[model samples]
Target: MIRRWIAVAVALSLVGCGEDPPASPGRFGEVTSAVVLVNPVINQGSTTSVATGGERSGVEFQAEDLTVATDSTGMALVEDLPTGTVTLDFDPGTYSFQVVREKELYDVVLAYRDGTVQPLFPPVRYPLGGEVVEVEPGESIAEAAASDDTIVLLKEGTYPGNLELRAEGVLIFGAWSPTRGPLSVIEGNVTVLGGGNRMRGVKVTGRLTSNANTFSAAFSDIASATITGNGVTLLRNRFTAGQATVPSSNAVLVDNTGIP
Candidate 1:
């Protein structure tokens, strides 16, 4: 009996020494961290180039109860963010900004909080042009365009899965010739992370996010569009459902037909 009591005591001690039980992740899943990069007020207008000054400071970052201020480098290391907390509110004294949580890092962009759209990702600078690659339906859009290839021409067919634009200045067109059939279809959500990208003559059946800078789409059909980039223009495009958000003063929606 004494040995059993000792054993119970030892077990209890071990339980106490062990790390506290992990907090429940809730419906959003495990908590994560993202590095938030912010540009200066002058650089905010240009996603591709940095202005005379470095990254700006004094930006307010808030998620839940956690609040942080950007350091001298205009960057904030935001931690303990729920995976479901895809968007965080940021306010620079001069302009309102939105911080989007990417898979690995956070992207900071100028946005107005009108309670219209959700946040997404940001871009890395790539060259303005690259070789064109032809992609068939059912082929991987991510794989069809290599790092060096920028233009992705989709033949008349459906591309599946969550599509991404990783290369800068990429053009994903439906490849319509004089003999036009149906528009090429992307049967998944698209997350754009490259700067100066364009999409034309395609049908996106899922939500579309232009997270990079200077994204333009023309004559395409999108279910929904979340424009997070600067200088984003949606022209002559049609939307089937959901809402279209143009929070940036630089973003333009021209002659677009949409049910939503």
Candidate 2:
């Protein structure tokens, strides 16, 4: 019985001394990060050029509360991210990308990613002679009206200075600019197509059409044309009635109220 016990003890010690099998590598957890790249195309009226590669401007990455990340080679590293679908926010632009991992590269082509990530530079839409020009927010419809070759199709938004439709054809306004700041003032025959457009400190000297919509102007003066809209305000300007028609919802005041 003693000899048997000794043998059993020796066997147990040898088992303990044997090296344990190597641990399996841990599974790669879900990791992701948001990345934004700049668009390369430059508009006709734009004064600056678009950036590319590492020199691209307006590129950014946002994950949770952090907005910065590192881009090495062709891949951007968003380390230690939880496993899930990650979104990348960028400016109103286009980009081409390649994912690089362990010396392997994968091409990534994205058309557009919409989010709160505002573009550093505003996008502009130049008229191709007679094409319909949609003025987006943060965009400007400058020199289009002055061009004798192009017919300016103005959308809903505030414009800077007095808009002049010097040509013979019709020039439409009310297209919304992205910024929607007070600098958007109209000085031409602006047709209000939709509601909820804010026009502050604007001076109109041409025909104004409501088109079953509302227009808000802090201070405006109507001269030699008809004003047809619901909400038209003449807060501080003099209205020399030529063919001015005020709609029910349109309000025409004679003093500065507040920011619209």
Q: Best TM-score goes to which candidate?
A: 1
Question: Which stretches of candidate 2 lie above 4 Å from their native place?
Answer: 1-139, 142-187, 224-234, 248-260
> What ranges in model 1 sit over 4 Å off?
1-129, 176-182
Candidate 1 clashes between residue pairs 3 or more apart in a chain or in different chains: none
**All candidates' TM-scores?**
0.47, 0.26
lDDT per residue for candidate 2 within 99-180, as digits (tens), equals: 2221111112122234323232321111112332334333445444443333232333444443433433322323222123
- Per-residue CA lDDT of candidate 1, range 23-109, in tens? 111100112444444542331222233222333576575655688776664555555654343455554333223323322222333
lDDT of each: 0.52, 0.33
Q: Using lDDT as the measure, which candidate wins?
A: 1
Candidate 2: how many backbone clashes? 23
Error of 1 at 206 (Å): 0.5
